[model samples]
Target chain A: MIDVIHPSLLLFLGAAIVPLLRGRAQQAWMLLLPAAIIAVVFSLPHGSSGAMNLFGMDLLILRIDALSMVFTSVFAIITFVGALYALHVKDTTQHVAALTYAGSALGVVLAGDLITLYVFWELMVFTSVWLIWCRRNPVSMAAGFRYLIVHALGGVILLAGIILHVMDTGSVAFTAIDPDSAGFYLILIGFMINAAVPPLHAWLTDAYPESTITGAIFLASLTTKTAVYTLIRGFPGTELLVVLGVIMALYGVVYAVLANDIRRLLAYHIISQVGYMVAGVGMGTIMALNGSASHAFTHILYKAVLFMGAGAVIHMTGKAKLTELGGIYRYMPITFLLYMVGGLSISAFPLFSGFVSKTMVVEAAALDGRAWVWLLLSLASAGTFLHTGLKLPWFTFFGQDSGLRPKEAPLNMLLAMGIAAFLCIFIGVFPGWLYAIMPAPVEYNAYSTGHVLWELQLLLFTGLGFFFLLKHVGGEAKISVDTDWLYRWLLPKFALGVQRVVDRVWDAVLGGLMRRLTWLVSSLTHHHGPQGILARTWPTGSMVLWVAVMLAASLLLYYL
Target chain B: MDLGRLLEYLVENARVLRWFAYVVMAGLVVADILIPSAYDRFPWESIGGFGAFYGFISCVLIIVISKALGYLLLYRGEDYYDD
Candidate 1:
């Protein structure tokens, strides 16, 4: 039998073309496509099967094993939720862009070789930026530009690494890359940028808040998490990641603590949560990698729910800043509850999805004999609750009444959040479905009595920590500093300096050229009679004599 | 404001107040006890290397203290960036 092509590709691609159709057809396709893709993603032969060679150098596409399957399944789920969430959106450009964007990420999951991976990788960057640009505002356009510059830098580094990898190895395998050369590190940096690794993470918080309401939700889901998948794939065993991961974790904690914007706070926690995953990847154990991969999988679910809730608030009241929003739960109770689940899940509260997945990464960190990383990871974990879990929902939904009476989110939006909320609880309650599909053996249980008890104790103590440090958490606004300032602010300033130097050189060159032209014209005018020989009126007598002399000379030469 | 009230406010609002300060002093005392000397002609790199976290925490605490000091001493208005 012909290999069952993953239905997601067909459905998304088909929906993409629907934008070209009539209005009724477009809306119909938008509704149908996500469901079709989700069904097809689950209906596949339930095992790894796809090609990995196209041009004799292995065009590696479609490897659907447990590791990738877990990610792909959640990706499909989010794409569905995101699509439903966008059902009321009239912007077909965004709809088409979102489809192609989601499809490219699926292609990445199925991609089994370096070439195919890069192809999907670049497209994910290319198509997703349109969602940002879809906001159709100058602010959004600028945000998209910055977002592209950073991701393009990542893409360039990634491409360079892949080229060197292919040249050195004579094969384009998409497997755990050894530290044979700096190529792996280049590849790691490339992936790390998208993973929101610090010194490179500002593009996320800076641009994500600027995306259109639904656009941010879609923007948040795919690109960074896909890079996380790549890191898990390529740099799993590398030890250096442990240090970088801890820095990222701490950076997220400190910044989230100081952030005043709600979306920015969530954005910071993205880095914080990914820290645990990167540390897990560094640990290199099967359990740890599985944890990282599984956490990456569950993270997208909860994060998308959080974004959806945030998007709903922004949609209803047109407010995203924490200072502008408060007491919205009075109107949007469903979204508020949805957001609470998301917050709890992300904080890793016991019986939520994060509790099951995040603990895996922390356990892996503790097991790796890195006490400092474990301590920081624990602090970051507590900080997650303080910033995102308590701070986000409390500020946006339940804080002092600002008396902004917006309506509840639309039905489609609620449907999306409801589905995501269900998954969050369902996964926490019954992780067997997720565990069975892990890339590694899944003997480590998330729900041991001791594990649950300690997690509660940890969270309870951290709750005390947050309330104790409430003054610190809610202190006067200061930009919690991080390494991203280097690129976002400092590098741009450096670029401005370089640009000034280049502009001076250009001006001097042009000045010289213009002066040289003036000099040449003046010299010609001085040498020639009346004016420059190049553009002058010759005397009639001289012209006639010259023509006559030329004729005479020609005749004389011919005679000779 | 009176001098005592000003000092109390500064101490209460100091970013690195108390906890990190105690840690820093404890660290210095530990170093003093361990080495028994103010300066070594050739100190082991391991000591400094191993002491990086304690030192980093100390520095971070100092910055925090500096911020509170800035508020106390250099309490600029909040509209600094506006103009």
Candidate 2:
């Protein structure tokens, strides 16, 4: 049965074959694979179905519960959208990497055991880094290297935790475990790194913007959200996540505000949006968990739409920095309108997808009686509107006319974006379509009078503040130093200084050894020369006389 | 209606739109007070126009504080890493 085959295996197998098919065959396969996977994903019934015994343990390979289903559905959808967007891209490596990356994420979401999850989790790191590296630029190559190092560290941490967790608990089921154990916390740290929690987060901001245009769409959608899914499955209600999540929510926004590059701005915003999901998971209530899951769902859509828009601009203009791009709407009005849909949706404006999903998390915080979290999250929302909603579009599409008159985005790009833009609005207007598929039953209404008024006043006044400080909010032609600066700049310089000192000491040690060898050679030469006792006629005869004398003495002794 | 022309017209008449926004803001503040809230877990909820003030203040602070920190500690030239 199609249902018997794992959707991820389908994708991996499809990726393996992508290079074989060429031209239109490859394109058809690229588009059809995700659609077929979607069919396979939906055909399977929700529960732990694909179970098999491997060695001593039972590996539950496919668990199609509501939570996994939510993420898996989106993974398939985004892969399709991403493939469509990259239809014009001739790079076979990127297509394969992206498909496999999506497949690995689906594998992560569906894995019913921790080991299964860990396997897919590590696969995600290797496959997704190629999406960045395939850009073939030095900057991307370097960024991809950093990205691999960070995620590999994360993978090691997760594996250590999984080993300890399985040994200690005697179970590998992917369920919420007690956070008191060292193993769980190690796992959490690993998850947090992939989730792009601050300090550990700079890799995301560093590598994502450096990805190929279509690659960023894939990069943006999968890794962190998959981590969020795993968190929901494994660590729902961990209290520390509340604080880290809030800090991440705000930290991302601050960096985003300082970002000059258009894609980097969006990348930082990914951290910010994911922060909301993390906070929801931290709240740990049914409503909050559902909120986090649903928010992940919606965030994937709107964020993808947002990336698609930014990508369209970059694709057209060959410029990614905001300082270098302006008044592009004149040339690409369709792209402009589509991008604004994403912008407004992300800001949680009423009737947008973000409004429905993001508010639920805040509402969950309020319902859980976390007043401070509620306030901070509210502030983050306003900030979200300030930068992504109002600032990004205003500066990029409509701000100072930098007079870049690139042609409109290619039709394939627009078609993919158009699909994403449509979904963003579709879910916005009819959120029940999304809510029905949530991990938990939906009880919250987004359009209550108070909620509407509050969000409206919040977003509207945020708009007011934007216009009030229009000049101040514009992007500068400067790059923002994130936590990656510690490794990217500070660590390398520190290493170089250490190397210089090491080199000097090494040279001195070698010189000292050489001096000693020279002295020993000179002493030996002096002692063995004609002027020395050893250099007497007997010795000067090249030790032959001495050998003859020793032989004679031995023979005399033998005769005696 | 031609959407581009409409958008252009909107952009050109920015001053009037700014005034209109201010008027809307004032009206919303009054409505915020008059319209009873459904959830009042926080004290700020009871305060009329709290959302407006909080939103405006937070947005301003996000921009101001972020820019201050950015200028002070975060930003470098585009070639900062390239070297």
Candidate 3:
């Protein structure tokens, strides 16, 4: 065993003290802590170490494989970026909460056992909520509470699955699982909720957009990435995910098309992009899984870029709805350009990072001879192009010129987006840098002529479709329908109905109970005459009458 | 020319245009099967042709019907949650 602990965890745990110190120390917590933690995480002991026994099976927590390495690197990068984004805030509660959250995610990646993983997993839920509530608005507080309920439910489900899985196979090892048991299925569902899978996707858009600006940036970076990590560990290669993946791909596109809030639109597309990863895992090929990891890594980068662009707009304009905001791109050109690369990357445009990685999943599907899935993927591709690829930037940055002049985003924000933008194109132009670091050996070429041609044709044709239907699809109105409409709308409606029934029942029962008590008391204390027994003194006539009545009863009994 | 005749004249016969467009769509779909792809493989898939055509048609039909009903049943106003 190594002595004095792994350096990353040491630095990360060490940084927890920074926020606790006095004034200047708080700022130091934001700046230096991330720098120190990243350095330490980058220096972890490489390769898979021996698995430690947890529950019953050997657990590999410190596996520095290609798969885990990409996420660990980006996870650390986001902490720094999210810190820079949130540095303006003075709230120590949010600062410490955010740092601990970033540290928890780091620990999860380095964890070797299921118990260790679960420990970090639950820590993530509690800390992330404080970041949201830092906005200190009634709506935000409510949204934070709603987010907590859902996350708590996810934690409970995951805990049950982990416990049952351990008991069943006598193994708490994290690896690919067969979907043959209640435990396995519950765990998949749990991960999918964090993944923002269907009917439950609303919490993401509902909460993230409502949090304080810096709070949103931190909220965007970590939660989904951690969920993607757990999914990669637990449910790689399961067939049912193919169906869920396809549904998410299309669902994101359709809802995104209708969404008016800029961040919510991006949030929907987050689910859409994760579909590529989920489908990749379902394909179960090594290439596909690698592609998923690559996609997740790139997605976090570009998505952060997108959210920052959005945050910049909200920073300046104080508006996020499409109707109220436009033409601000003229004011913030640097931010606009940075955001464009992110958008293009997510759309899987040729030579962008998305094109290089997403194809592997598609190729794996074809290799597996699942033609229907291929068609669904193509349709989702068309939708992605229609909604996010062409629609997001075209309308926001280059649309009917809303003529609203907002100042450029702050220096650090622009710098962060620029860094992400450079990576988007860098990985697109030279995918080898990423390919070199994939979880598996790289043997695939994303530059094939057929592949390039088909993608261009698909994206171009979808763009053509968008122009044709812009009239039907265009409007400033925010459409409030998604998996979220269920919890946000339907759940409350159902609760109101149940409450009405309960109120009526309770009122009737209590009313009857009050009446019966009154009736019983009245009967017990009745007085027959004007002079009651206790009100007047006892007279001689009354005593004599009582004795005469007794004598008469005795004589009557003797005669009988 | 009268208004109807003027419209027809500018469009080159309305019925003729509709029929022409329909014919062209059918032609492209038919050409897909007859023309040899560069790989010498006809991309015409035979995996339950109804699944490609009529299954989709039925699914669309059901959705349209269900959505029409849900529109009336599940409608909520703008301020439902705000208050």
Query: What's the TM-score of every candidate structure?
Result: 0.79, 0.94, 0.82
lDDT of candidate 2 over A447-544, digit per residue (tens): 88888889989999989888889989888988888889999899999999999999999999999999999999888888886666688565467588
What is the TM-score of candidate 1?
0.79
Best by lDDT: 2
Q: Looking at every candidate separately, what fraction of the true A–B Cα contacts under 8 Å does it contain? A: 0.00, 0.74, 0.01
- What's the ranking of the predictions by lDDT, best on top? 2, 1, 3
Query: Cα deviation of A183 in candidate 1 (Å)?
Result: 2.8
DockQ of each: 0.03, 0.74, 0.04
List the candidate numbers ranked by TM-score, top first. 2, 3, 1
A132-233 per-residue lDDT for model 1 (tens digits): 898898878977998898889989999999888888888787888879954777788888888888777888887887787887777788888888898888
> Candidate 3 DockQ category?
incorrect
User: Chain B of candidate 3 versus the native chain B: what TM-score?
Assistant: 0.41
Higher-DockQ candidate of 1 and 2: 2
Native-structure RMSD, model 3: 8.9
Model 1 pairs whose backbones collide: A62-A110
